[model samples]
Target chain A: MSSTQQTEVGYVVSSRDFLVYLDGLPTIKVNDMVESDTGLRGWVTSTFEDKIEVLMLDEGAIKPKQEFRRLTNRLGINVGDFLLGRAVNSLGVPIDGKGLLSRTKTNLNLELDREALGIESREFIANQFLTGITLIDTLIPLGRGQRELVLGDAHSGKTGFLIDIVVNQKNTGVICVLASIGKPAVVVRNLIDTLRLNKALDYNVIIATSSSEPPPLIFLTPKTAFTIAEYFQKKGKDVLLILDDLGSHAKIYREISLLSNKSPGRESYPGDMFYQHAHLLERAGNFLPEYGGGSITALPVIELSLSDFTTLIPTNLMSMTDGHLLFKAGLRSQGQTPAIDLSLSVSRVGRQTQDQMTNLLSTRVRQVLSAAADLETISRFSLELPPETQLILKRRELIMEILKQDPLTAIPKQIQAILLALPFTTFLQNKNRSFVEKYKVIISEAFLKHPQLIPITKSITKLKTDEELIKLLEAAGAVLAKLCP
Target chain B: MNEILSIILKDTYSLTSLKHRLRILQSYFLKTFFGEIETSVNMPLSPQDSNWLKSLPSSFYQKFNKDNIYNIFSGLEKIGTNTPILTMHLAFELNDTTLSQIGAFTRKTFDSPSLLLDIKVDPNLIAGTALSWKGVYRDYSLRAKLEQKRQELLEEFRKFLR
Candidate 1:
């Protein structure tokens, strides 16, 4: 290691937009870094005969015949717990105006596109990943290492919902990494401010690229975020990764692909679009104890066109993920703040981590909601219905009312279980939607902090059946009844 | 090789010069065959092109018919693709005689007359030359030699500073 280390050099032959083709550096592989004479940086994208293509990572010009030095570093970014509470770009440069990150021994240089662990190194997901959302916890349960797609149309409260999830992970020991790809500057600023205000930034890392950045830099956002997440996950820490939206990521890739002469496939996307995304996402999973025993729960977001999930990108994401949660602008307009369209959403691996009582309750809740939907269609004729049908309809109303939680609120799992079973208790018999809306916060606070109820809440897992839990809740309602009376 | 191909190699001593000749040939074909033509360089042939044509004997023109025109182009293209380029950086620009002298020496040394030279004017070289061949760069310039003795130079400069 002499001070004057001999490095391979390349010369730019042709350039178009952000893509530059070099006629030399015969040994340069894809994703290796190269620095121009003007000090701009680029990542080698592909290698052709006697030439290689590069995507510029910085905001600068690389002219034809300009010289470049091939760096030994492959595609990588710096990582550490010091990255917590800071915002950085794809190159690991701090963008939050927070100067440099504090020096820590945990700092590491991790590859941005490291290969994922194979099935032999992966363990089955055994623990539940909680977002503190009552409806999701009770119905579409998620496992600690599952990759779930969060999808909806624009303005569907998707970002707000994602922020709620991050905020709710406040003290849960789950490290959060949010990759905000090609979002507006204000959105990133507001997100940082919100996280800081909630004190959630202490445990969160944000990798952001604005829409105005170079396409190549924006294209690296999600991969950099995943790299940071992998760092924490390998340290035996649970990580929650949120890719704000991959729709913009796909478009950037398409632009890069079409410019580099890749033939377009369906929807004008490159043929390897699926492989590119799947490769990035496959890095997330639960590792076996022999492989460090940690889990990475990824929520990759995609915005649909006019709520059409049948589009190519959305369907591709759906097929790759364990399940999807479809938010709806229609519901958001109806005042369902952070509106999650329930019927369309599915969770493939979440049910496995749920307790038996929760599994039973979820089945009953689904049955009632399904029957109510079918009966409501028939009841539109103003025909008389049986007493059981009326009770089912009333129960559906109560369930929907209880599930309408405010933004930034994270209800505990025991409280969610107690709240969902309350409709079965005698306490909520005469309660209307307005009544539940007015008292839901007070009820949740009481259940969380009440001296007599904490034991029952703690013992929720011990209760074997949904009826047994409902019975315990009915008894707990006695204390609430005295207070609310 | 055909005499026409051998003729194209004469005075084409650099990649830049070869590219210029290729562009001129393309423009010529565009004007002669296509109804319209557009190139980075304008359609009109310059003195250099005329000089190149004059250097060729009349037998070359008799050989340049439409049927074998592609044979000539494909042959030129093959030479362009295969010829290795050597880049040199010097402190000052060279005169045509100096360039031709340097070109002759390099052509004789490398044993390939068709090899191309890509020269760059770099004032920082300071009275010597830096060369890059096939991406391997070696700086034999006076500046590099001085930089190698930078520590001793700095120690001498410190005496003046004090």
Candidate 2:
């Protein structure tokens, strides 16, 4: 239909905070845009027989009996490559100090909410998505286009770990988009500053909304972030989209739903709460070349309460995503920077993307770690153990120490495999915990430099078994011991 | 319709007319409930209120107690808010005769005798009407016609100027 025939107008009959009930605009559908006389914008959320509910995008001087014009289009935001390295709000307006987004570079306004393409439009997720953290890279890997939930309690290093991933994407050709939804203003600034300090800002896009904005506006931040990521993905560039805490997004939706008088179900959230999150998350996937070919690897963060993963939002997210990586506050306090609980974490798609050698090696590492955990509990009750059991307990402690990496350091896939395999080799028997801590980087650097170890790095691709890879490192014992000493 | 509502229903087809007649009815009821009709020495009703009382059915005398007066005012106020209105924009302000004629035409054509008129004066309409109902607005004004043939009119004006 022509814009003229679709034209409708409404007068505000009643208003409460950011929500206004209009008496006309009978033809306005949900997600349509509306604006008041003074140019305040809103999204049409619910339509009744004679009234429509609009959640205002901005807090303005709106009063009863005010006329609002129906905008011609559904709700959408302008997007472009000019958005990279800049921070923007839910409206696609630049919030960074740099400048405005160049309108010429942007495509026509793209609606934020979109359903995932059908199965025919998608390909298998077969490439590993590295996050520089050795613990996750080896134990709980994630794949391109995978939707992995990064969940943790307060001070569990979730934010720090996410920043490390963005920083590590520096030269990898992967575009990073971080959505800081409903965070404090200072926290958003801190995130941007960390990216800038690492010189990672130029390749990343930050879509942020502070808690003080209107609830509906704050709630649109993740959707806006996804839209910006898709803009880059359309050109077949890989995108790592991080939603830094969807927990706040759920709360904001609950607030809007309750105020709109929708019936609140479990946790007083609206009945469609699961659908709201599931639909947004379903947009991420490895797509076939017919549909952009590139992938959107989404790491949606959720802050848990007291490390309880059984809560409504966390469990709902678990069932929706490919898998989750659980971060813990206790581990953070004990000097584990990323603080991920590998035993609790699972990756359904990442293992498929791993090389045959790395796959076998990680399985070996996990089996050993699991056995050590069981024996440690029993060793505390008894006084002594067999010679092999004692060695196994000692090896587990050394493996844990090697995995406890500092923030902002990214380990390569080969180096991560080599590092995890160190505890199993006899080379680690002589090296003390303090010795390994000081020279681990030196040992890792030797993989590229040392004469004997350099060929092992190339030979890793041909090695079929974890035992062969471990024996190869053990044979280069003189070089490893010299580097550590 | 209640006899009290019917007293002004025929004349009260517009929102402005409905409010004006309801205000008069409210005063007539208030004055009579205070014993103005029986004692004749109570507060005096204005000419409009007195005319309203004269138009009321004689049985209204039996229902003009305190409770009925409240119910009658509440029901009229409810109608004032709930009534569907058709807005008319005209080149000139409406007079009583033109408003009643438009109201009668609309009531018969739309089959809603209780429908209300919300009149707006827009001189730019240039001697024709623009109407809005149920949020849909359309221009049937002379201004709209002139704009529709704007290029032809401009050519004629240019010829005259040359």
Give the per-residue lDDT digits (tens) of candidate 2, residues A394-456: 887778888988888988877888888888888998566777788889988899788788898
lDDT of 1 by residue, A1-485 (tens): 22242456789989999999987786788889999978999999888998899899887777778998888778898788789999998889999998978666455788887788899989899899999998888899999999999999889988888999999998889999999999998999999999999999999999999999999999999999998998888889899999988999999999999999999999999999999889888988899877778899999999988899998889899988999999999998888866889999999999999999998988888898999999997777767878788778888888898888889888889888888888777788777777777788888888778898788888997988999988888888888876665
For candidate 2, give the docking quality class from DockQ: acceptable
True contacts kept of each: 0.28, 0.44
True-structure RMSD for candidate 2: 3.4
**Candidate 1 per-residue lDDT over residues B1-162, each given as its tens digit:** 445555666666767777877777655654555535444235556776767756767776666555666777777787676777888888998876687788878988998867788888899878788877787667778888788788999999999899
Best of the candidates, TM-score: 2
Q: What DockQ does model 1 achieve?
A: 0.30
Q: Locate the minimum summed-lDDT window of 10 residues in model 2 chain A.
A: A1-10
DockQ, all candidates in order: 0.30, 0.40
